[model samples]
Target: MKLFQKLGRMPIGLTIPAFAILLVVFGIPIVLLFLASINAPAFSATNYLGFFAQTANVRVLFQTIEVSVVATSICLIVGYPTAYLIVAASKSVRITLIALVIIPYLTSGLARTYAWIVILGDRGVINNLLLQLGVIHSPLQLIYNTMAVYIGMVHIMLPVMILPLVSAMMGIDRSLTAAARSMGARPLTAFWRVFFPLSLPGVRAGSLLVFVFCLGFYITPAALGGLRDAMLSTFIAAQVKNSFDISRIATSAFILLAIAVAVLFLLGLDLASAQGRTATTAWKSWVVRISKLDMLKRYFSRFSDSYRAKLWTTQLYQAGDDSRLSNIVGTMFVLLVMVYLHSPGLIVIIMSFSSGTFLEFPPSSISLQWYQTFFGDPSWRGAAWTSIQIGVAVAILSTIVGTLAAYGLNRTHPRLRSFLTMTILTPVTIPVIVVAIASYYGLVNLGLIGSRTGIVLAQSTGATGIVVVIVSATLANFDRTLERAAKSMRAGPLQTFWRVTLPLIRPGVIGGAVFAFLHSFDEVVITNLVSGYSIRTLPLKMWENIRNQIDPTIAAVSSLLMLVPVLWLIILYLTWWRSRLRDHRSRPELET
Candidate 1:
């Protein structure tokens, strides 16, 4: 009782358990790994020099950067236009499109990568179709190439780019664009001048997110690209597999981390500028730097206005003639993008039902043999059961720890809260490979390398961060006065929270638990490093089969994995809907 009262008095104490887990599982080990990288006590550049001396190492390093840049550019190019069209659609259509985008985003990355394999393998869908149609004499070298890497990467990353853009575009006042049109600006001109500039922050955010994620391109590039296309992550994994050289692996991991950090510093500093004073200073400095450009813009605007005045009436009358044609084209483009985004998963699901021994797009005979095979295989069943147990444990641990951390942070000073939040989110923000390497060291010290508990803790580090973010967003909108009113009525702190706070935040808690489970269930990179090759979780087993052989049973597994995101969406919708209903019913009571 005394300890509980003391902890309540010091709200920050509530965060102790979360921070303790993070420090033990991730923080200390990372610091030790950095020391080993430099040969601590006699800190030297020899390890780094040795890393860069190899020509193949240098080439792989540069190739990693090049591939990341190209992939990020492709996502931005495709995502920007797709986002604009989605935002321009009717409200119902916008909602549907957003949901479509998120479904893929939440689906397992491994499943998506496998979908590409089913579509692009030598004897896969495209070649088989071409041969059947007599369009080619032989299969084209498609699956293991740079082009396939780009396609697989863009397919996975497109949603990450689109969602941010859509959110940013939604916040812009439509009246500004309408007002621009009223002043004789053509739609194209108005959009370029008004909307594009406003969407830059979204572009920056999405590009940074994609580029950083690309630096950690393990599954896609390795699965889709040839030997020459390996990124730093694939290289690091190979190093770990071939030789458990801690120093070598740490050096490579830090090099990748350094690149990610440099990019974040360039593109995401503004994201962390929570202090108004710093933002104000940066804004003023940017305004001064662009002052000359403003003059050039003014001159260009004057010239454009004069040119538009001469042709405004003619262009305005001409616009009606093209409106229907433009709409048709826009609709077609959005549909094509949607097909590109979703067809892979659909193809995998359909192909899973084939009666053939291997995956084929159109089955000669549709049957449930593959699913039955999945059920009958003891290895598959055991892996899945292990994954379920680990996922449920991670969910329970992350949700409790994360919710408490969020509650404490909500009551902390704003500056401190921002810093702590960023610290907690580091596991998810950086490359998965880096987190894997660090967690490997952490688990080694604990002698938990081959244990399920280690995997759960490793996964929960990232899962906890996810829970914190979701629940914090929920807490931001909570009505604190209700808690205060409960307290004033002689309710104890625990009673006030149980009666007033928990019910309001239940939706966020449930959503956080779902996402945490998903994070743990879909995890492969970290689980691979820490699993010691003894424990076989579903994703690890699936990834093993993917690398070793083409198993028809995996198709059944992938199809089921594809349904996870849909289930997540349904669960989230129900929770939020129930919360909304309660809010609606209580509104009249408040008024009375």
Candidate 2:
């Protein structure tokens, strides 16, 4: 009884389960992978040398970097202004626009990629519309090219870039920009001199996130890109499939990982500091920051004063007149970006109902035939069932483990918490391919590969990380006095948590569970490496059919999968609303 009481009182013990699983599934195997890469025991770089010696390997490596860079650049270029407009809008309008971006973000990447194929295929919407309008005599080559690869990648990654920027920008005080404008700065000048610099952390974070994710892209590049446009991930997957040379495969995986780590290091991305800076920072830090700002000011000052003067006068005229033209343009630009983000999913949903034998935008007749086909196929049903089982297992496992970890970390010292949080988040933060390779190697050693248990454990490693993040965010906002008050009433640690803390954090726990399920359900890259060809999850089946173009029934699957995000949004909104309602009820005096 005393031991139980003592154990319950220790917060650090709560994290042990999560850490143990992560170590078993990811940490140890990654060490093994590194050792394999260097030809352990004999310890040499022969495998790496052989990799670089090959012309094809060299081309693919450079090409992977180029594609990732270009895609991230496009996302940033588009996401920055879009996020600005979103932040600049009215509160209600801003929420609506953010929702628009998030709907696609939460949607499955595979479904979105399929949407791209349907729109850009040779006989796809674009070519069909053009042909019918007599604009072209024949279908144009659109899909299976480098451009299609970028389109799919940018579409999938834009929300990632925009969300981080929006978060960072939202934390900035609007009064700073207003103050700059009052000091004779034009709108452009205010944004440049004041707003833009404040948002650099967001830029760094969003770019790094997009760049790292793109480096590990497997499905988008393969399904949409031509043979010559293969990324390093595709190359690595091919090697895994075609050969059993562990050293060669390990070397490739580590090289891809090295580039991601190098970029992370170069950008100096500190996840702990990325949230925003506090006013309590040292004066020296501010001085160094100001010097950097001065350099930027000088560079911008090089442009003509005439252009600046004209822009300042035009802005003053517009402000005095309260012109709606600029507002309209900003709104229009936002609408167009939303459309670009959503069009592919919309196209896929519409095509799923086509009664014709093949997918087309304007169906000859609307029918549920494709959905019926999907349900009727035993193979499809089996795969979906397998996925459901794995997803549920991952959700339950991750939620229990992650919530405890988050709770423990919440009570830890700040410095230690930040370090542990980063360590916990490693599975999700790095390239998915590297995690997959490590998980694969780990499962093989454990003799768990090719089993549903392996898939669940493999997915739960990342899912648990996501859960920790979400739950930690909720804990950040939680008032600890409630728990203290409960404890003061003679409640023990377990009793206080069960009776007081649990109710307050229930929404976050639920959200984490839902997200964990989605993470497992949509995961393919990791599932592919670890499943060992002995099991087929729904995504694996979908990916197979997609690669072969064997069935139009996948359109129906993609359409249905798109609804998952909508459902997630509804669940989250309700949970949040209920949380707020409960808080309001408890603080009726404040409400009055």
Number of the top TM-score candidate: 1
TM-score of 1: 0.94
TM-scores for every predicted model: 0.94, 0.93
Task: Residues 261-315, candidate 2: write the lDDT tens digits.
Answer: 9998877667444343432243336866878677877778878667877776777
Could you tell me the TM-score of candidate 2? 0.93
Can you tell me which runs of candidate 2 are displaced by over 4 Å? Answer: 1-4, 271-323, 589-592
- Candidate 1's C-alpha runs over 4 A off are 269-307, 313-319
Colliding residue pairs in candidate 2: none
Q: Please, what is the whole-model Cα lDDT of each candidate in the order they appear?
A: 0.90, 0.90
Q: Can you list the residue pairs that collide in candidate 1? A: none
Question: Candidate 1 residues 270-356, lDDT tens each?
Answer: 543233235446665687797988778887888677777878766765647577988899899899999998999999999999998
